[model samples]
Target: MTTDGFTTCLWFDGQAEEAAHYYVSVFKNSSVGRVSHYTEGAMQPAGTVLTVEFTANGHKFVALNGGPQFKFTEAISFQVFCDNQEEIDYYWTKLTEGGGEPGPCGWLKDRFGVSWQIIPERLDEMISDPDTAKSSRAMQAMLKMHKLDIAALEKAYAGE
Candidate 1:
């Protein structure tokens, strides 16, 4: 109904502010916006951060200090489509640093437990090719990699 785009809300246990700043630092064209604090009689202490508004890579997000009841899982993840190996490597390294866990097929959990997919922009085209053989090779190659290698995937797609 409304023309306003959606804003993704991330829940954290007393880390809303910290996460907001961290995300801003990691992304280009990003900055921290409004920060709301809890008031008297709130679940959290007065003056404690309740939510932090931030923009990362031009996407609106709100980080909420919603306590420890909720945790990030792999079921939901953010995908970063990269133009080349360098872009993939940059995102993978930055996201996986500081205790982030690398998963299969370019999936990884950052230090804050947020799952991310650092994938090449062309990966979808390769994996979804009409030719089964080429697509299968690319899929197999991707399955074996933690951080995606664009050249390797391309080679596989070409049956090289």
Candidate 2:
């Protein structure tokens, strides 16, 4: 892993700790990391969690109780490359439990309002197929879906 990895910092109004824990529980290979606290008088409300680092599915994220000046949007999204339909379905189901909204092209917003794309591995291949017609069909099929159906994309590619 020569590429240096960086964590995405999330600014939560008052739920940094709760969000960190929730994310840790959702992903495999995840764990809560160093939790730094604000020393007395350091923050407006002292004793708050200044930063809580957590890793989910091997990706690092830091949640900070940084007030409500900013919020998340769909412009940036985490893409989960799932090898099979089972993995895709599992993530899609788990992430949408609270207020997560399922969108077209395998995209969803978790309860935390963070965007995620649960994509099938084969879908990329199909979209890149040498045959333009096959690729077009697969692309068209993907555009109509919420949680992407791998089988449907395959069927579209096969002209079914």
Candidate 3:
């Protein structure tokens, strides 16, 4: 991977343009990129968009209105490593707009049906503690919640 970074392409049935714009509006440092369309009599009509490229949070993504043969699954997800609770809460709230649902370990599905994991960077230390008892407590604490609470994780790690 170059310093330029990598981008992920999301396939939408026919809402590529709309979805691209929506995502660009959400994250900072985001903008819609090139838009290409199929020529007349091509696979799709001339005015019909063939691809829409967009960037969000500095990550690039292409939305292809390639029909409905594929859909987003839980197998793939975006991970948001939050350094503080405010950031976590902000992302969680914004992401859950519409029909998004919160899941364990800070996992959530956005209104657009995109899965995301909003977690604190400190979680690695808490879960990877050399002490098995502390690790167990942290795991238990983590399993019971949807949006991860950094404070609670820290408390558990400290045996508080």
Q: TM-scores, in order shown?
A: 0.97, 0.92, 0.89
Q: How does model 3 score by TM-score?
A: 0.89
Off by over 4 Å in 2: 1-4
- Model 1, span 73-97: residue lDDT tens: 9999999999989889989998888
lDDT, each prediction:
0.94, 0.87, 0.86
For model 1, the stretches where C-alpha displacement exceeds 4 angstroms are: 1-3
RMSD of each: 1.8, 2.3, 2.3
Best-performing candidate as measured by TM-score: 1
- TM-score, structure 1 vs. true: 0.97
Model 3, 1-160: lDDT tens digits are 1236666888887889988888787789998988999887776678888899888888888889888788887899999889999999989998898778887778998876789999998888888889999998998999988998889988987899
With candidate 1 superimposed using the best TM-score fit, by how many Å does residue 86's alpha carbon deviate from the native? 0.8
